[model samples]
Structure formats: structure tokens, C-alpha cells
Target: MLKSTMNQNKVQTLKGFRDFLPEAMAVRNYVKNLLIDTFETFGFEPIETPTLEYSSVLMGKYGDEADKLVYSFTDNGDRQIGMRYDLTVPTAKVLAMYSQTIPMPFKRYQIQPVWRAENTQKGRYREVLQCDIDTFGTNSPIADAEILAVINTVLQKLNFKTFTILINSRIVLNNILKACKITEDKNSILQSLDKFSKIGQDGVTKELIGKNIPKAKITVLFKYIKQAQPDEYLQNVINQLKILGVSKNNYQFDPTIVRGLDYYTGPIFETVVTKPK
Candidate 1:
């Protein structure tokens, strides 16, 4: 009997992973319920996908760092597979695979765990839950507006304040990078520039210089990002893109944001919470 008990205790979770107990699960369920209710009220439907996906499907979708972090392995059938890294990529694959079957402009809300073979930090874990709401097959601003409104409503109900929602477009960033003569290989440089808020402008400038980006161009880029309003920034970018023969509407320029994700093709946004520590 003692040996059996010892054997049970010896089994443990891998490092950087965890198992939620009942009390924690109850709280999690409650939060998830609230999020589900909010998303459903906004006409977002629930969908689920497999936890395992073909390794090729998830690779290169979330940038180089994320690609390196994917939990890939060979199954008994000698097929390479990976644990789902984020709800978005799997959802995208589902859309492409069932393009003919699913309804157009599919609005989906998914809550699932994603695995990452990376270091954990505060408010981040190797395996964590992501709540995503997305609309496919529509390029309407109304769709974008609805997503923003729904997210704002959910956060308001949660009593979170002192935060702002920053929105931008990847096209706009790409144009800016082009203006600075920075190649696409400078994704890490751009990512560091995006961190200006968290690490300060001086820190970002130093990091960019370290990355071998020109100091004068970095100064110009930083000044551009600090524009006070979206309208002013849009005007400048619109003028620049016009000279380059790119339409203003196509970029969907919004000055309020710099999204962290590399895969976001159109409008991108981030929520900044300023609750007291």
C-alpha cells in the first residue's frame, strides 16, 4: 500500500507546465463563462479544433521565435506533428480546409490551451489559455468595429480601467519600414521598436543600433511612431504611400497601435491594462 502511494506521488508534471486543481478550475470556468457570454452576445459562435496539427501548418505563421518554440514531435505513424501554438492559426487552417462547407463571414470564438517551449514569466506560461474572436471572409470596417466594441464591453464588465486599446495596420508598418530602407529581415529590429513603450525610447534606440540599423533612420522612425493622433500619422503615411502608388485605404493605417504579432495582415490591435500593482 505504501509503495503504491509513493509511486503515485513520484509522477509529476514536466517543468514549465502545470495542472489546475479544482478551486482554480472553478475560477477559470467562471471567467471563461463570462467571456463566452460576452462573445456570443456579439454573434460570435464557438468552434473547436484538434490540439495536434501538422507541423508544417503552424510553422512560419507566428514569426521565427514562435516557430522555434513549437512543440513538435514524431508520432508512431512517423508523421511530424505539433501542439497547437495559438487558436488563430488553427482557426485559419480550419477556414481554408472547410472553405466550401462553412458559411461566409464566419464569426468564431475559441478558448483553448496553446503550448510553447519557451521560458515562462509573469502573466505568461509555457502552456496558457488564449481567448480569440475573429471574423473571416469579410473585409468590412463594420466587422472591425464590432470586434472592438465587443472586446471593450467585455473589459468594461470585468471592471478593468486605466487602459487603452491601440490599433494599427501591418501594411502601415511595412510602408514605414520601407521608408526607412529596412529589409524584412529586420523583423527583430521592428519588434524592438514596437517595445518602445515598455522599454523606453532610448532603450529601443540602443537596441536598434545594436541590431545594425542606421541611427538617423531609427530616429526618424521613432519620431513617426510618436505622432499624437491617428489622423496626422495617416496623412503622412498616405502621402508617402501615394508616392509609392499604394492606396491609403489598402493599408488601413491607424496610428494608435503597434501589434506584436507578425501574422496580422490587416488591422491589428492591443489592449493595455493599467491596473494598480
Candidate 2:
């Protein structure tokens, strides 16, 4: 007997996801192609990886709150598997797997969709597209400048103006937090504070309080978080970049911008559209 139409699965996409109609897809393709061209122009070669990776490989890298949002499951073989949350970790894995074949100082660009099972906000979803360019095996300041240039190029090419590039250093934030008696669970605390923009100071206070971080400790930490960055390393980086001829107009030194990724050992930055909502 044939299955009844009523009993069939509905042709609907999951929550936090949507069907991209032709027009929307066209716009997406145009933007993605533009980004790809920009990356290639900067000498970043393209690379791809599997969308699914071992949960073990992804976990403990993005910190606690992020790990909680990973779409993970145990396969029939009893191996824990997870969808890629970001492109960086998988690229590291690819480099490790093909180290013999890959050359030193690999410069690669990967464009793909990443998954994170969380409450979707406007223009943010459980699954979202990402375009990334990464370089490894180098500690040169020039590499950092090229990255900033690529970012500026991509945004300018997309006709974006009035955007701010907020920069911070995990090492700096970690030092400040350590002085606050938060000698451990730093990522958990950082992840909690990561919600400050969305949930406000009181919300972050509540989260850290629930984490058993002393109220006094949170108070001390928030004090320094609101202050200007006392770390000179990032300041020196800024000066170097200025010497490299990158514009200082878009640079913002936001101490509270502790990215919730455990693997971020040094500097971290994000571009924000400052247009009025």
C-alpha cells in the first residue's frame, strides 16, 4: 500500500533555518562570490573539509557555552560526532592530516555554513554561513596586517561603511581576570560575560553568581572590564599596524570583548555594523 499524503513528512525546513528562494539565493551567491574573489586576490587559496567532525575534535576549543550549543550525537558505531561549528578547527585538523603534503605557512580560505544549536536572534540562526581566511606557521606581524587589510577590503567591496573593528587580546583579558582571583574557569566566566551585550551586566552577574564566582569577585572583575586596556602588547600591535599603513579610524579598543573561544590564545577582533537599527 502507498503511504498517505497526510502521513508523509511535511516539506518544511527546521526552526532557525529557512528555505532560500531564488532571489535570496542569488544575493547569497553574489556576496559569497565577492568574498571569494577578495580572498583569492589576497593570495589565500581555497580549501574544503567535511561538515561533520568528531565531537572530541571540536569540543573544549570553543569554551563551555559554545560547546553546549554544538549539535552532537553518538553514531551507530558509538563514536561521538558533531557538525562543524566553525571552520578554524577543521582546518587545523586538515593541516595535521595532510602535513606531509601541505607546505609550510599554509594560507587558506574556506567558505561554508556552520551549525550551533542555540536560540536564534534576528539574522542569527542555528545554522549560519561563514567566510574565513586563515594562515598558519607564522608569527609575523605582517600576516596580521594582511588579515586586517583583507577584512577592510571585503567590507569595502561589499559597500559597507561606518563599521567598527573591535579588537582585544585573550592574553590581556586573562591577566586582568587572574588578578581578580578568577584563577580558573576563565573561559566559563568569559563565556558568561560574552552575553553582556545581549543580557546586560545584571544578567552576566547572575550567570557568574550561579557559577559560584564570588559576588565580590564579579564586582572586582567588572570594574577592570569597564576600564581601558592596560595591556601594552595590543597597543604595540596597533602602533605596528599603523606603521604598516592600515587605517586607525576603525580600530576600537574594547576590553569587554573577550571572545568565548578557549583556543584564542592571543588577539581577537570582530567587525560590527554600526548602522542604526
Candidate 3:
């Protein structure tokens, strides 16, 4: 009995990891296939990248807060390396490397596992599968609109009854902060603001105040954020979405929808399901 118990302990998976048995894997694979089909239908070809990248390549991309969650180590080669944090960075590297060969406006989808050193939570994990579709070589809001349409199609196809795709632009966010005379600590402010959904306005105020942002500036920040409207770029994206036949009910402009990722420059979006709640 003692030997059996020891063996079980040795074989157990590490914390924040999971082993999907056949029963679970069946469902997982089903969803993966569905995503692949949806992606291909939208002219997105499949691509894969390495699970490990040089430490230098991974650093300084995501903002300070998210950078801390990256899993990195010095390998036996004495070379510093990092596990994939998310699919976007690696895909960007791919585009740069093959820029000579790939045509403009390239669309690619990636489905793979990524690792991060996050505190274990109910629905969050250190190792999680990521499914992403990215369009490179385009500076058009129409491209952004296509992404929104794709999100709506994917979720609706999966039988999601009620969900909203929240969209925001860092341009508008930056403009608001600029109007507030905030420049030096913009990243910090955006990181805190990204938590608006989880933490209420009061919580965000507390966080900003803790960061030594002047109380007056905080007041101005909130005021500007409330008064801010989507710029012409975002307005064009919305108009294009309607042209693409994306239901207006599925997506809306949300000022508080600032994504936590620092690398994001233009439009950022997130989805929330409301039916099961």
C-alpha cells in the first residue's frame, strides 16, 4: 500500500497543469476542430511556432505587470529561454522573419498550448490552450471589423445565446489621458483601468491613488474617460461591421474594455457571456 501511494504521488501532474482523459479530450478536440473550421472559412491559414523562444525575444513586449508572469529559465546551454506566454508575439516574429515571402494582408490562425506562471485560480491555469487568429500587413479598420464578425460567428456557432463583444481603442484611451495631462505613467494607468470589470470604479480609483497619481489627475481621468467618444477610426470600424452583416446586438463600443496587453496599439476587444450568469 505504501509503495502504491508513493508511485501515485510521483505520477501526479504538477500544480496549475491538467491531464485531460479520453472522455475530456474528446470534447476538447471537438471544440478545436470547430475553431479550425471557422478560421479556414474566413481565409485564415494555419501556422505553428515553437513553444520556446529566446528570453530577449519575449521580454519588453507585454507590459510590466504581464511580463512578470512569463515563465523563463536558463537552460543547460547557458542560454536564457522563455516559454510561450501567448500566441501573438511569436506570430509577430514569424511575420518579420518571413516578410519577404508572405504576401500582404496575410491571415493566419494558431491553436496551441502556452505557459505562464500565474497563481492558480478556478478558471485560470499556468498551462492553457490558446486559439487565435491574426491578420498581418493590414492597417484598415475593415480588417478590425472582420475580426469582430469572426468572433460573433464563432461564438454563435457554438450555441452561445447571449454574449457581447466589447471593443475599445488605445488611441482613444491615450487621447483621453493626454487631455488629462497624463504621460509618464500611462502604462500603469491603463493596466489598472483594464481591471474595471473585476474591480469597480472605486477599486480602480484606489489603485491609481496608491500609485501616487495625483487625486486631481484621477478626477480628470475619470471625467475625460466618461466624455470620450470613439474616434473616426473606431466609427469607421463600426460602420464596416454593419457592412459585413455583423449584428449590432453582438458588439458595442466600450470605453472600459482596455485590454491588459501592452503590445496592443489599435483596436482591442473582449467577449463576455451573459446567459449562464
lDDT of each: 0.75, 0.83, 0.89
Question: TM-scores of all models?
Answer: 0.85, 0.85, 0.94
Candidates arranged by TM-score, highest first: 3, 1, 2
| True-vs-predicted CA distance for residue 57, candidate 1, Å | 1.4
Candidate 2 per-residue lDDT over residues 228-265, each given as its tens digit = 57366677667776765667776677777777667888
lDDT of 3 at 166: 87
The deviation in Å at residue 187 for candidate 3 is 1.0
TM-score of 3: 0.94
What order do candidates take by lDDT, descending?
3, 2, 1
Model 2 ranges off by over 4 Å:
1-10, 74-79, 119-121, 199-216, 230-232
lDDT of 2 at 222: 87
Across 81-114, the per-residue lDDT of candidate 1 in tens digits comes to 9999999999989999999999988999999988
User: In candidate 3, how many Å is residue 18 off?
Assistant: 0.3
Instruction: Find the 10 residues in a row with the least total lDDT in model 3.
Output: 182-191
- Measured over all alpha carbons after superposition, the RMSD of each candidate to the real structure, in angstroms, is 6.6, 3.2, 2.2
The better-scoring model by lDDT among 2 and 3 is 3
lDDT of 3 by residue, 1-277 (tens): 9989989788667899999999999999988898888889999999999999998889899977788899999999999999999999999899889999999899999999999899998988899999988888888988888888889998988899999998889999989888999865788898899899999789999999999999999999888888878899999999999899988898878888788787888888999999757
